[model samples]
Target chain A: MYRAQVRVRYFEKKAYDLFLQNLVKGTSHLAIGQEAIAAGVAAALRPDDYVFATYRGHAHAILRGAPMAAVLAELLGRQSGLMAGKGGSMHLTYAAGNFLGSYAIVGAHLTIANGAAWSARYRGTDQVAVAFFGDGATNIGAFHEALNLAATWKLPVLFICENNLYMEYTPIATVTAVARPAADRASAYGLAPIVVDGNDADAVYEVALAAVARARSGEGPSLVEAVTYRHGGHSRADPGKYRPDEEVAEWLAKDPLPRYRERLLASGANPAVLDRIEAEAHDEVEQASLAAQGAPLADPAELERQVFADGGATWRR
Target chain B: MATLTQVATRTVTYREAVALGLAQEMGRDPTVVLIGEDVAAAGGVFKATAGLLERFGPERVRDTPISEQAILGAAMGAAMTGLRPVAELMFADFLSVAHDIVANQVAKARYMTNGQLSVPLVVRFGNGAGLRFGAQHSQSVESWLMAVPGLKVVVPSTPADVVGLLAAAVRDDDPVMFLEEKALYPMNGEVPSGEHVDQLGVARVRRHGKDATIVSLGTMVHRSLEAAAQLATEGVECEVVDLRSLVPLDVTTVAASVTKTGRMFTVEENPRLCGWGAELASIIGEECFYDLDAPVRRITSPHVPVPAAGSLEDAMLPSAERVADVVRRALG
Candidate 1:
C-alpha cells in the first residue's frame, strides 16, 4: 500500500513537471496529498469488481491496474494513451481492469455506479462496484437519487466520499448544512455510514474491505466518508492561497507519505527496503515520463472516428 | 387506394405500435429492458409502455425514481456493461434536468473512450405539444438533442414507422433519442406484423409531386401530408417527405425531391429560431441552392414555451393550413 501511495505521488510529481514544461496539454487534478485513499480502497477490491472515480482519478486508474506509461501518455495527449488522447486527464477508462471510467461533472457517476452494481446483481455476479466522489457531490440531486435508488433496490454498491473539506475554492463547511455531509445524508437513505481518517492507508483499507464485503453479501449499499486534505490547487493554475497558512501547515504535518514512512520504520522494518521502494517508484515514474515523451501524437483522422460505435452510419444521410 | 385500405387489417394505435416494438425487442434479446418512472405499475403517462411490465415481469420492466439524471445515467452505465436499456422520461421538457447525462456522458462516452465503450442505450420521451399540459410538460425539445454528435435523434410520425424505428433504435449499437409525438399517440394505422424494421437514415417520400417539396417529421409529417393533399386540388403538386430520423437526416431523398420540384418548404413543431426546421432549411440551401426556383421556406412555432390553454397552444404549434400557405408561397 505504501509503495502504491509513493508511486502515485511520484507520478503526480512527474505530471506536474510535465505541465510546467507545457508538454501536458490539458488541466489535470492531481491526487498528491490524497494518495492513501486510492492506494487503500483499490487494494480492497477484486480484479472483476468495477470502479468509478472523479476527475482526480489518476491514482485510482493506476492503482486499479492501468499501465503507468499509458496513463502518462494520455496526460501528454498521445496516441498510446489509455483513451488514445481523447479523454486527456479528466476522463480515463480501462475496461480490461474493470475501471469503468471517471467523470468531470461532480456527482455524475453515483447513479452510474449504482447501475453497474445493478448490472452485476442482474447478471448474478458477486462483483461489487465502488463510486469514488467528493464531499461537493453530496449536495447534488443525483447523489441523493443514487442513494435512494440503491437503498430501495438494495444494490451492491459502495459510495466513497473523499471529504477534502473544499469544493473547489469554497470550503465545504460554508456550503454544506451538516458537519459530516455524506454520513448525515446516508441516514436519510437508511444506509449505515462509516467515517475514517483518510490519510491513514491501513484504516481506509479496513473500512473499504468491510464495505466491499457487505456489498458482495447483498447487504445493500454503504457510504464511507474519508476525511482528508489536498496538497495542491484544485487545478494546475490556482496556488490555493485562499486557504489559511496555519491550517495548511497543520495538515502538512499529517502528510500520509512521511507518516507511513515513519510508522514503517518505528515497527522495526529495515530502512533500506523502504528506501529501495521509494527509489523504485521514482525510477518507474521517470521511465514512464520518458516513454510518454517519445509517444506519438494522436492522428488528426482519429477525430472523425468512434463518434458512434457504428461510425454514425445512420447519422450521415 | 383500394389495396391500401385492405392492407390496414393489422392496424393498431400509435401507442400500441410502440409497445409492440419494445415487447418484440425484449423477447428477441434478453439484454433489452425497460426502465423509467411509473413504467411498471402505471404503464407510463401516455401508455407507450403499456402491458410491458406484466409481459416481461418486474426484473426486465423497472420503475425508476422521479430522477431524470439517475434514469439516463443508469441507462448509460447499464448499456456500457452489456444491457440494452430503454430509459423513458415523462416528458421531453424534463430533458433540461438530465441534459448532461445525454449530452456529455452518453453522447461522448464511445468517442471519448476511443471505441473502448459503446453506449447502446435508448432514451424515449414524449415530445411536441397538443395537450394543454402547459410549458413544462408540453415541448418539442428534439432540437436540443440534434446538436449532440454521438446521439441518433429519431422522431416517428406513423404507427408503422414508430414500431420499425424503435426496433431499429433498440438494436443499434449507438445511443438513440426515441422522441414519440405525444399528440399522435391515439392515431391508428397499419403496421407490418412480422419483422418490420426501418433503416435509421432513410426518408420515406409520402407523396410524389413536381411543383414544390414539403419536408417535415413527427406530427409535422402528417400535417405536411395533409397540406400536400390540399395543395393537390390547386394544381401545386407538392412532394411530401417524412424524415423519420433527425440526426441521420436523409438529405439525399429530400435533395432529390427538391431537385425535381425546384422548391422546398420545411415545417417543424418547435420554435423557428435554431429549430430542426432551420437545420433542414440551411442544409437544403447549402446543398441544393441552384435547384431552387425560390428561397427555401420554413414554417415553425414562434420562439416561446408552450402555453397552457388549448387556444394558445394551437396558435404556437404549426398547422396544416400554415404548411399549405408556405408551400403556395414557395411554388409562386
Candidate 2:
C-alpha cells in the first residue's frame, strides 16, 4: 500500500508538477487529482486481474503493476522502456501481470476488454477484466458497441469511467448529454450501473471489488463511473482553464492521498515504516527513468520490419 | 514418387471456395472465429461464408452491429487476446469509416508493442467495380492498402487462390487484408480439402507463354487468361501472372516473367493514375528494363468514378478485348 501511495502523495502536490518531472521524451498527461481513481479501483483487484486503460493511463499502469521507472522509461522512449521504446506514453503493455494495454483512442480499449474477458471466461478463469475510459469517451460509438456486446455476451468486464469532467478542454456537460452520470448508460444495455466518489480510495475500491466479484462469478459485466478531477492540463499546454478555479480548490481540499494516509495512520500503520516505503518508491522511480534512458532501440533497418508477417513472431525480415 | 490422384481436388465458385477455406479452418481450429454484419444468417453479402453460422454457432460466427469500426476493433481485440478472428468489411469502400482502427491500431499494434503483442487478425472484404454499386461502393483501393507498411494485402482471383490465401491469412501472425474480386465470385476452380495454405507474397504464373507477359490480379487475372487464349488464335502467346499479395509484391516472379517475355501488358480495373498497375509498370521499367522489346503497355479504367450505367461499367473494367489489344500493342 505504501508503494502505491508514493505516486498518490506526489499527485496531490500537483499533476502538472509530476508531468513536468516525468518529462521522458514527449508530451505527458498527468492524472493529478485523478490518481485516487486508479489507487481506489486497484485496491479492489487481485494481482492477476486484467486492466485496460486509455491515454491518461500513467496512474493505471503504475497501480496495476508496471514499475514507475519502466513506465517513465517508456514515456521517455528509451530502449529499456516497457514497450522497448516502441509504445511511448500512449501505449503500454504488461502481459504477465495481465495489464492488457493502454490505448490512446477515446473508447477503443472497451472492446478489447470484452475480448479479454470473453477469453477469460472461455479459459474458465475467474479473472475479471476492467476497462478504464473517460466521460468524454462515453459518447463515442465504440463505447455503445462495447457495452451492448458485453451485456449480450455476459462477458466478465468491469467498465470503469474515470469521469475526469473533461475530454481535453471540453467539459462533459458540453460534449456529452451525460443525462445522469455516465454510469446510467449501463442501464440501457441491461447492466447494473454504479456511481462512486472517485476521490475516496476506499469508496472506489469497495465498489470495484463487488462489481469484479459479481462479474467473475458469471453475473455478467458491470459499469462503474468514478466522478473524479484532473488538476493539470489535459496534455502539455492547457492549465485546465475550462473548469473554474474555485472548483479545483474545493476538490484539492478533498485530496484522497492525504485523507487515505490519515486513515492508514489511524488504522495503525507505523509512521517510520511509511517514510521508508516512500523513500524506496522514490528511489525506484529515479532508477527506472535512468534504466529506460539507457535501453537499446530496434535496429533502424527493422524500421521497415513488421508491417507484415515474415511468417510467425519474427519481425527480422 | 508420383503424387497420385488419391485426393481429388474439388472445383467451387470463388465465393464458396473462400467459404470452404474458412469453414475448413474453423473445423480444424476452435480458436478461428468469424465476425461481421449479416455474416451469420445472411451468409455474407456474396455468400462467402455461406452456412458457416449453421456449421459453427453464433459464438464462432458473430453478426456485428452495422459498425465497421466496431467489427475491426473487436477483431483486433480478439486477435491480441487469444482468438484468430477474421472480420469481413462487406465492401472495401467502407474502409474509410474504420480508418482509425485499421490505419493506426491494427497496422501498428505489433510494431508499437515491439513484438510484445501480436494481432493475428484478418480483415476480409471485396473490392473492384462492375456491379453498378455507384461511386460510393465501387472503389478499388488496393493501392491504398498496399502502401501501408504492416498490412499484407492479398487479392486472390480464382476459387483455388481464395481458398489457399484465406487459409494462409487465418494462420498468419500479422494482420492480413484479404481481398476478393467482387466480379469473380461465381468463377469456379479446383481447391484442395482441409487446411490448405497458400504462400503469401508469391505471384502464380497462371499461363506460360513466351511472346509477352500479362500481369494481373483478381478479376483481371481471369480477363488476362481469356485474353491470352484469344491471343493464342492470333498466334501471340501471352504469359499471365496472378499477383497474390500486393504489399509483399512477388517482384521476383514478376521480374523473371518480364525478363523472360521481354514485352509486358499489365491490366487493372482501378483508375489509371496511381493504380497498382501503374506501380507494377514502374517496377518493370526499373527492374526489367533492358529486356523490354517495346514499351510496357497497360489496360486500365479511365480516371473517373464508376458510372451507374452498365455500358460504362463494362468499358471501365479491363475487358478481355482490351487486355488482348494491349498485349498486341506490346507484342509489336
Each model's DockQ score: 0.69, 0.43
lDDT of 1 at B97: 95
Question: Cα lDDT for residue B62, model 1?
Answer: 97
Among these predictions, the greatest DockQ belongs to 1
Candidate 1 falls in which docking quality class? Answer: medium
Q: Residue B237 in candidate 1 has what lDDT?
A: 91
lDDT of each: 0.89, 0.79
lDDT of 2: 0.79
TM-score of chain B, candidate 1?
A: 0.96
Indicate which candidate wins on lDDT. Answer: 1
- Considering only N, C-alpha and C atoms within 3 Å, which residue pairs clash in candidate 1? none
Candidate 1 positional error at A295, Å:
1.6
**Model 2 over residues B1-332: C-alpha lDDT tens digits?**
11134656777898888789898789998888899888999999888888999999888898878878778877887787788989999999989888777888888877776776788989988888888888878888787787665788889987877877888888888888998888888787877654567777778899999988889888888889999999999999889998878867888888888889898787887888888878888888987789998888878888888887899888788899888887776565
User: What is each candidate's fraction of native interface contacts (fnat)?
Assistant: 0.68, 0.41
